[model samples]
Target: MRQRLIGGIGRLLAGLRSPPHAVLAHAVFPADEPLSTLPCVALDTETTGLNVLRDRIVSIGALRLSGGSRDNTPPLDYLVHPGIRIPARSSAIHGISDTDVAYAPSFALVAPSLLGYWQRRVLVGHNIAFDLAILRHEAERIRLPFHPPAAALDIGLLYAGLKPRVATITLEAIAADFGVTVDGRHTALGDAETAARIWSHLLPALSRLGVATLGTARSLMAKQRDLLHGQAGAGWAIGDLLPPHRGPQHEGAPHG
Candidate 1:
């Protein structure tokens, strides 16, 4: 599995004219590596709007969780100047005004560090496809090759998969269901901390569903492809997860 991961990333790297420092050769992990042993980074992005084609990321929040540690690494929060006027309605939702980001760095300036920090860790978040999409756009705008983490988990999708009958799967709803406190509701870092907590709470449930490893989690999330596509309609910015297949000769792994 490790070799397969290496080969897969190698192929991707070979295609890149110049893979950035973010594309570390050692970032890829074995498919069957246990989830509990793998580090995870909970991420969130506050954007200008819902349209991936036009909107830009205004802020990014990410925190590293070592071996699924409840106490996560110090969080990284960046406010970005999106180079366009921030809509008043959008500002009303996230509380990030033009003045707030007036002195902030542009996405191009932040991309290297942000992508580097995100490399080699499983990315977890609530309805994360949208966040991933926004980041992909930012990377493309800067002509940076966005090589996302080997795996990404969506708490909303995971919850929906486990409790298919539930109607509400909002970030607030999922955090509330898991008794996670919502301190930073709209801010990137605050939401990321909440997501990390929700992921910690959801781990046991995931295990019970037979999703014990990164590969199995990939399988589980793949089942939520429809939901993922709906979240990131452009399709290009969604699902940074490694495919379930180990090789062409083998069938795709069993879904969680």
Candidate 2:
């Protein structure tokens, strides 16, 4: 009891010290809410490079899904001025070039709308920690308080948790596993849509794995974090993307 109280106090203090615009304004969904009925923003980012510390987001693609429904709206796609030269190798992979974003809006110009869209929605991505790290740095550039969704989910972590023997967890590999075709390969919107579909297919299987609620899903991710630790390309743990006050809450241990 004393330990729990001290931990609660520590979380409270951390929340108090966070920037005024901490992403989580309130718990939009309860910890016990069914993962199947959870609203989520499936998102992806095309960036200048893999190094989160120095790289920048060249484009962001996202599609929002309402609780218990499939995506019905067009994706929110943006090509932002990354404030850095797009490396040739990076452009070769993501197909975004300096000329393409020459007239694009700066990250500062798009941060408000992007942040607002992410509010009240669980952010879902493949290897989400890297994307979150890049976004955090971008927000920090503008001195904006940046915190990812308290209930964020990583498909890579979930897959690793469920299929520990799978050697790769790339979006394309997982998409193929689920029979989801590669539409916009390497494009932000295309990958986001594919992830959302793959997530939908994984929901039932994850439920069978004893991951039915947000908390259980988080617990599973926490269990699988070590497997995905260095996969983010800079040693960023999956949990590093979690909010300061919102450590992974384990309602119950996930079954194999």
Candidate 3:
């Protein structure tokens, strides 16, 4: 899997295709302290494939960023049976065979915990759209309509913007540039850790550049993602969580 990730990247540099352009959007940005001080979760997901509309989520990892700075909390990760067989090729990349998830809890069994961790907060990730798509699908699968976060930011965009001279900015590049090590290249927790490292490097630099505002950072992230698809306002959807369900606090309990 390690070689696979490395080789896949190698081909891109060897001129396999034109590297995707990362265009960050222009938007209203305030100072950095509010965004930096707020609580956020750095998240990642390993899916059955790149197509979230069709692919199932196989695993999820999130590291909470607290105290308005980059020190992340203990990571939260989970493996789940996606109710479909894991494709051999996909499993080969992630190294998670079907048997590895055979008896794993379904998403439902763990959604509350997921919500408990993620409920009503800003979020951060490397390529956050990929993770957000998986999160939206996972929520939709169980009839839970998930609106995106009120504020969200991507370390990938921040890194790209900060490094105007780097012609290419992949996660590996960003990690290498910042001296951050990725221990588990394909694992969910590993990816989340990498994302955090990316943030740790980028955010402080942004602060130094007089770009310490959260609103500005999040707006730029959305613009950068939209640029991927030749669209605008692509990344700024706000998902104010729905009110608590009109039911009991615990399963099998009466409604309030």
Q: Deviation in angstroms for 100 in model 2?
A: 0.3
What are the RMSD figures for all models against the true structure?
9.9, 11.8, 14.8
Give the per-residue lDDT of model 1 (tens digit) for 146-247.
Answer: 777767777777888788788888888888888889987998888998888888888888899888787777777667655655554444344365364421
Our tally of clashes for model 3 stands at 7
lDDT of residue 129 for candidate 1: 64
Model 1 regions lying over 4 Å from their true place = 1-26, 70-72, 232-236, 242-256
Judge candidate 1 against the unseen true structure and give its global Cα lDDT, from 0 to 1: 0.73
TM-score of each: 0.82, 0.81, 0.72
Clashing pairs in 2: none
lDDT of 1 at 98: 91
Residue ranges of candidate 3 with Cα displaced over 4 Å: 1-33, 67-73, 222-226, 230-256
lDDT of each: 0.73, 0.73, 0.60
Ranking by lDDT: 2, 1, 3
